[model samples]
Target: MSNYPKTALVINCGSSSVKFAVLDPTDGHVFLNGIGEALGLEDARISWKHSGGEKTETPLGAGAGHDKALAFLVNNILADDKALLDSIVACGHRIVQGGDIYSQPTLIDDEVEENIKKVIPFAPLHNPAHLLGIDAARENFPNIPHVAVFDTAFHQTMPPKAYRYAIPEEFYTDLHLRKYGAHGTSHMFIAQEAAKMLGKPLEETCLITCHMGNGASVSAVKNGKCVDTSMGLTPLDGLIMGTRCGSIDPSVVFFLCERLHKTPQEVEKIFNKESGMMAVSGVSSDFRPIVAGIQEGNERCTLALQMYAYRLAKFIASYYVPLGHVDAIVFSGGVGENGPTTRKYVCSELEEAFGIKIDNDANYKARVYMGVDHQVISKPDSSVKLFVIATNEELMIARSAMQFVK
Candidate 1:
């Protein structure tokens, strides 16, 4: 066995926080993982843990941001172990938007950085934070290769018919206003894992991957490539999310502005931050609380769960047009991996329409928290198989980074 270092450092920076992990690209084993949150606030802090070790935390002091967090990662976290630091062969950055230019993971360079910057308007809050992290990581670890893994890259395979909006030609031609799905990394990871669990070659497998989380999307992966996805030009166009309303009438915007006398920005906020499960359930956006409310006989919570499942099932059935025959339906992401009740509700809706005979016992048991990474939750006689596969975007990013390291 080669003892040479084969680890990749994965960085996911947000507007005010940084999430990082050092893991082996080969086995998906995390060596260290941490988060630095509340940057530029009064109580900025970072917490981390070595593999199989107790977690440790430290305050980064006020006004600290990406640079200070990354500096702490190098100076205090990895400094004591030279071997660990040396083992890092690549740095993988999670970029939320790549616009139309990149279809795959690209090695980070000055030009690549500029391209990312150009897409800032598409991912205003996320891309800038990613750039900050990239710059900081480059300064902190100048020796290793850095790679950008875009969240929209996988969905770039969609045909024009699937991605195009029915607006004026000049809108798309001038401003590039078309569908660009989110959760590409998760969908890609789930498709690959679903193929493995089904014991089929990736190129021969067809899947409808439902990444159900606070922010959710459904994707049609036909023969190892994304043929269509639920999300559009922005995540706001997709399935009803935790806070964002999905796929509403276009005229509602004008209604809110003209009749309600609301500004564009306020209407935007209403769509993005004041709707979906939170607004429908009158409960927390987190699924747990909503589920609890259902148990307590809260009618709105029940309605919310019904709406969520219905929307998900509708998307799954609609994907049948893109993928003629699905080999499996994969459930992934935070809610998909753990929300058994949600899975049950959705599967019940799909059973009659799609001939999916889900095994209730198996579905409830297939949870990542229970150490079940892969589970076949369908009966053998079912026409379509069902699976719950845990997603690992960090591992996917690490593997992508490793591909360019040599």
Candidate 2:
């Protein structure tokens, strides 16, 4: 291995978006960060910025796709700055589902690529996009090593009891179906950060990590290992999110199909794309607007907020049964870091029962933009601590890739 410090290029691809970051893993210094969005659409565009520099957005004509967009990022963006491109040592791709086959980051090869393709059914919306970005990056930079960092890897430590669904045995044995949680990267990152803040070794720490955003999930981390998580089999099984109706009863699907005369695919679309906050509030899926609607005396919005908070609190309390004694409850991701009202609402009922009193003043200050990514929002005398930590999945992916390169 070379002694010189080198940057790691991290790629995260969604159905219609591609986010890339180049960072120096040793010091966590991001060199360049950008995204290409609205792929294949008339309004497709790419936006990027150098560290400490103003952002630049460029429109890509209607035919632009992932490969074309990635080429632009490399040939037009990084190529303009040769030094930065030359310093890149490896590439890391964030893969959503690795299935039971991959329990850790694996160096990508023909076999690994085939395995990734095989698991596409488990992550229909994510894995294909990831493969596109992976293939594009590999072709764009053929010399460097590339790694696939799975979002489901960290939660592989979950016990069978926590992951197993009470379904037919053949479904699991033949199809490899079970509750493989999502947001493992974010959950693992925050759990370690929370352990550091608590002045305890990760192996001895117990934490409840809430990764709340447009997509949300909570994990119970016991002594550095994941015990249980809210999301299961797919991301749709988690807490209520921007569009997903998390943890709905299976019978609801039957009702939609048999009673309402809706097809399975139609019901699936409604649950995954048209429900949750958007369905309940009938205003917006975003938390800010939902909270605003509550303040404006919208009953549906108020009920939506209450239901979201109640479910989150219930998950937190339920995890306590497995953890026995808790050290801290960590709030991370988009909404968790900025939405103090949501945080307050989530802990409202648990304050007395679980000793999770939120320090209103401190809770209101934990915003990523304010340089306060890590903060303790719990009352000083409270038995259980509460923290808000910014989740850094890209950095974590970079570090994971570094281990293989080194």
Candidate 3:
């Protein structure tokens, strides 16, 4: 076994998959990472890799689920390396919605699990899966502390003016119908890294961070806290996403349900599952295929790409209201870090409107392939700096979990 620093086991559990990693919180050194996929299916399987090692896969028996998959993770994978298992100081679980109650990572106890259960309606698909993973991990690693790192935690700092909708006061007070932004973990990580790149303290930096992926959100951070963000009540309220309809008029839902004779659930499925780039481009939700279609002269695909960049740029520009003196505009996530074409379109829009210059050569070269974790994409003389900072949510989770290690 290699010499390893104290690490945290980070778990991001979904309905059918559990992504896990063991990483040192100090320098973000990953010791191992893997996933338990296709849980509860006939082909339920687990795949993993030790640091600097080849991937190995194993198939669990038919109908295996979270409990069984985590059992295999503990008994088969982690057990193989005694030192690695011993180095685990804590377990961190990523939770999607913590409501207004949890503003920071909390030590997981019976009370915390109960609190997660209370917010089930806000994140029906994610919180239960997280609880399952938490239960399984706690069962396996009984000696170590378990912490909950919420995706909504960082955005909880948003003031009432930012989070509250213009609805009736009773609705917000009684039902909690307020914005609870997602991707807080990614936003927080990028903000910290961007501050480091800017050679300033995080508390002194003002940034508009855009995290664009299959699911996308932009946040405005001023003086080290979230002042405002693009996403709202749910992730579907944000900028256009792979399959989600971003911000649409409320009447559209009524029009579809009342006039077109569709149920609320059906309309929800249409907006959440059958919209965005897929509906716009008549191509796959994946940007790669849409780009290919654009190359082949598909107008729909061209419109899709244009809409994606335009909507994203508009969100970033809007955040300028909250962040008066912007230190930088950060682009991170799958599409943000890798898609130079999208970045060009977005930065161009900002340039025309706000004079945020984008260096064509620098923007083209700043990407995952270039092996730079963070790089400025804007010209030196630009009014506001632009950056392509790769986000690391797992490491952030590990760091949060580390806080409870003692």
Candidate 2 lDDT over 176-218, as tens digits, reads 8999999999999999999999999999998999999999999
User: How well does model 1 score by local distance difference test?
Assistant: 0.92
Evaluated against the true structure, the overall lDDT of model 3 is 0.92
**lDDT of each candidate versus the true structure:** 0.92, 0.91, 0.92
- The local lDDT score (0 to 100) that residue 116 gets in candidate 2 is 89
Per-residue lDDT of candidate 1, residues 1-406 (tens digit): 1243579999999999999999999999998999999988889999999888999999999989999999999999989766788899899999999999999999999999999999898888899999999999999999999999999999999999999999999999999899999999999999998889888899999899999888999999999999999999888887888999988998999999999899988998998899999999999888999999999999999999999999999999999999998899999989999998899989899888778888989877888889879888898988889898889999999999999877
lDDT of 1 at 61: 98
Better of 2 and 3 by lDDT: 3
List RMSD in Å for every model shown.
1.6, 2.0, 1.0
* Poorly placed runs, candidate 2 (over 4 Å): 1-5
Please give the lDDT score at residue 136 for candidate 1. Answer: 96
Candidate 3 residues 1-406, lDDT tens each?
6677899999999999999999989999888999999998999999999888999998988989899988988899988998899999999999999999999999999999999999999898899999999999999999999999999999988989999999999999999999999999999999999999999999999999999999999999998899998889888998999999999999999999888999999998999999999999999889889888988999999999999889988888888888888999999999999888888878887787788999989888988757899888899889999999999999999999999977
